[model samples]
Target: MSTESIRPLIGISCGDLNGIGLELIIKTVSNNKLLELCTPIIFASNKAINFYRKSIPDSNFNFQQIKDFTRINPKQVNVFNCWEEEVAITPGQLTPEGGKYAILSLTAAVEALKAGQIQGLVTAPIHKKNTQGDSFPFTGHTPYLKEAFAAKEVVMMMVASNMRVALLTEHVPVQEIGPHITKAAIVSKLKLIEASLKQDFGIDRPKIAVLGLNPHAGDEGLIGAEEENIIKPAIKEYKQQNNAIVQGPFSADAFFARGYHERFDAVLAMYHDQGLIPFKSLSHGEGVNFTAGLSAIRTSPDHGTAFDIAGKNKGDESSFISAIFTCIDIIRQRTAYRENRANPMKKLTNRLLANAVDEKIEE
Candidate 1:
């Protein structure tokens, strides 16, 4: 299909209503100009939108209610009503109902993704603790999606215009972070990061910088042995295999300070805070959280649901807006990648056809 004709359907999950989820969603789609890029189907309800509308009364964002994918309006913001029962809408207050509805919207959007009803997914933030229940036992979206799609691996990578960072361990306590920093784990993530860069981001070859698990990168075993015994070896092995350019075991502090981050396509940190702390600082509220290595594309705003300013209409929507654009851009890139892979000889075929036509004209 023509690029213009194939405007990807992006499924947006309403995160914790108590936080800034709904507010950001409304702010993102408030401008009608965004519809020209792709069709957005929000997995939320009219009531939730109305609640946020009251908070931000000046927003021009509007939603077209749809029962299913068939009812989507390409030119308008579409809301798939996940539930009809009136749930209490208390902005800025965390409640069981908030988590419950967040799951509802997320689950609905995931189903749509699996069924091929949507081309990609851009989820809003969901409070990790309250969103966890019998159905969603995992800590966050990465693990849940890994199980949902039966994906072998999914790397939680944060993307800003200037920097890209991936975490080796996600949502784990600081004390428990060391155990997960083994050679095998680091190697696994390195390979995943390399492949994701090539396939998702269109980088032919990716150079990754790896951070150490201890202070001063173990200070050559003075602080910890992880750098010498685990992280360094993994980087060496992966590099020897000729997969991609992998280097590091750098001290996390100095790496970002000296602008070493710009040397590589991506940086692999040992834990969440190790990576996210610098990423958020550099991103300036415009970072996008991309779950790489999934069969489908999924991106979310890097920031979490800000409960303190939920109902105040004070939430910044730049990250959310960037997330939406990122999804669309990735979908387009994937389409082009597939087309190129599917027909490797297209260029040669065109050349041969042109030569034959010239010969026929001469004859």
Candidate 2:
């Protein structure tokens, strides 16, 4: 079979139409080399694509518009229209129309994923406030996808070439964050992180570093008791029970400042900003926000909707491009992991038989 026929179908959700989501999609797929890796099916309308096409100069970006998945072009970028009615396109402005259509695109792409029409999903950034309504009432993609895929729990992991970071509590207020950080929560997130590191990233044994909640990781109970009472106990229990290579309750400030994150496979932060602040700073626009521990793979650009640079063609496509490649990579890893883990006894028997034949020949 041709390479195109074997390539996986990756679904793309047009984030907020008013933002730089479509622009990033167009620029990323325009390279054509990306098409060599996987077929892209963008979940947006032809009209919206055309609108953004006019703003970007000399993009040479082209796509095949299809009403359904029956006619997906494996070698070209495909546009799957989620809506037929004409919708207003207001670049750089947060409008109700933007949120409504973003939901339409996201829900459609997710359904395609569920139906096995697509193997993976790469979502553009969406505005949280505008997208909230009775139909969809979640903070961000991680929570929303957790509900969509019926996953018991999911980790919001930020991945890059240098380091990988996962959050303990995401989208929570500072005052509320303290209450959420408990022994149970810490142990639960560690479990998800451990499983994801193996299943998704193909790490046989992952060394994870846990960051502290207080300024100096509770300073041995001077700053806070979470480290001595809550954080330390959780880490201890996890290590003793699972015999896993996990460490810390490390001071967040010194951990990244001293280049300590490089020593481990991944880092688990206490909250959103604690992990993301350093990650974005260190990743330098190459970070991809990956939703780990889910049956279906989903990734997004680490940045949010940039209203100031929207439609100006100044929005960097690097993170969005990285998200697509990360999605593809995870799909391959998961496939390989499953194959390696399937029927271990059969593999061992085959190995033994080969070894016995070799011994007989030597004799």
Candidate 3:
């Protein structure tokens, strides 16, 4: 309710109509509270939504479709029709039409974000192979976003609940991670992650723990040299930053095993398996994947579209629900933070806090 935050209109992109993207949207959109919090505008076709409504049972929705981007009535469902024709949707069937709209929806979301028409975007899952056909140059949402945003540093941090893990490397083969490790890359990625935690998630002073590149964290130079050589130095350099205490080079197995995982704000894993393994194990069906270092707030469910269970009325809503809630929270936080920094009084208060933290430490 603070002046810093405004009710933002979220541009929701239906990933692939055939996938569980449609199902998740159908399930989450039924709740009226979501409509009240922020305007829900589909960056897809009226045909697609309607098609989904008809194809899938238990879907109770009537979207008021629109042709262009405009301020819409809160109660009525608004859609910017990127594809008006019927997308050939056979459950789990991948077609050029499906690829076309998937890109169309993504394009619409990007345009809406760039134009400042929508405050944030919540994207559904899109299959890399199916969507790109043969031109699947980028990996996934996070990388594509990084490229579009002109991001110098980017990281995919999956947050389902209290357990949060940021990947130093994502969507890459296990073999590629070792050669890619560099001090600057580590420093830059962590800095972006730190800023995002405070700016987007409202973590005032985010304390992050970094994971080691090797098993047993190099075990005094026995396991691997990267931990003692690269990760340790990067953590040391970042620990000097204000309110950003970088603690890491810990054993991946031991780090998330105990309740100590709750102590820090976020964890930085050395590689994909090191981070996602623990993250998925802990957060499974209930987490949301947030792409950091983009121009606008973008979030998605951590899980993928279950091709096998596409229309069974059996897909769990935990990840989808979490994505919606996370989008709401991030948009609000970004709005609030921007609003607060705009006010001289609030800015001064923040400055004082930034400066006073060290005093408490000395005391």
Candidate 4:
């Protein structure tokens, strides 16, 4: 298939409908300009959409409801009813029904993703507490997706305009983070980070900056020993195994403050807040959460469902829009990456073309 003709079908899960999930989806797809980039398939019921459509009464967004994937309109926003039965949707109210339907939409979308019906996924915010059930008992999307796809490992990386930050330990208690920061986990995360940068982001050689668990990188072992015992050894082991550029047990405070993040293509933090705090501060509300090392492409807004502004037509769609764009870009990049690997002649042809251009330049 020609690259130009291959428009990815991006699936979006309507998160806690009571929250701002439906509102954000409506606002994002309202722009006809977005339909040109990728086909958006919203996994939501018609009832849920109607609730938010009435709340935000000014949007011109419309959806083409399809019962089958083959009937999807590539140029129009599409909605696939995950459940046909009626479900109550009270915007700004938290209830079990909100979580139940959120899981239903997510489950339907994930099935499509696995069957290759969708090329990528852009998830709206879901209430982590209410999203729990027998089907989904995990803390958040990363773990749930990891189990669903049977992926060996995954990293939660937040992408902003300036830099990309990944977490070594996600959604763990502060006291428990110390125990989870082992040499094996750090090394595994490093491998995943390097592979993701090259394949997903198109970086030939990505330099990753790793942060210390304690203050001032353990202050040469005085402050803490995680840097000396676990982190430093892990970096050394990773360097010996791969040629990818890996550096630091740098103090998190100074690394971000002094703009050292710019020196590397991505940063690896010890825990969630350590990386996310800096990323969100500089993201300008355009950050996207990307799960790396998955079998499929998935991205979500860095922020959660803003229940405080639910149904008020006050939610900003910038981050959600950025998530869609990021998911599409990654899907395209992954396709090109796989194709080049499958047909090595393409790489050789490109190298010959480069050398020819260099010779002409010299002349």
Number of the top-ranking candidate, with lDDT as the measure: 2
Candidate 2, which segments miss by more than 4 Å at Cα? 343-363
What is the TM-score of each predicted model, taking all chains together? 0.93, 0.94, 0.89, 0.94
The digit string of per-residue lDDT tens for model 3 on 126-189 reads 8877765455467678877877778877778888667778888887788788887878788988
lDDT, each prediction:
0.87, 0.90, 0.75, 0.88
| lDDT tens digits, residue span 9-125, model 2 | 999999999999999999999987787678999999999999999998879888999988999988889999998888998899999999999999999999999999999999999
Clashing pairs in 4: none
TM-score of 1: 0.93
Superposition error at 277 for model 3 (Å): 2.0
Error of 1 at 234 (Å): 0.4
Of 2 and 3, the candidate ahead on lDDT is 2
User: Which portions of model 4 show Cα errors greater than 4 Å?
Assistant: 1-4, 344-363
TM-score of decoy 3: 0.89
- Give candidate 1 misplaced runs (Cα > 4 Å): 1-3, 345-363
Alpha-carbon RMSD, candidate 3: 5.9
Q: Name model 3 segments beyond 4 Å from true.
A: 1-5, 133-136, 241-243, 344-363
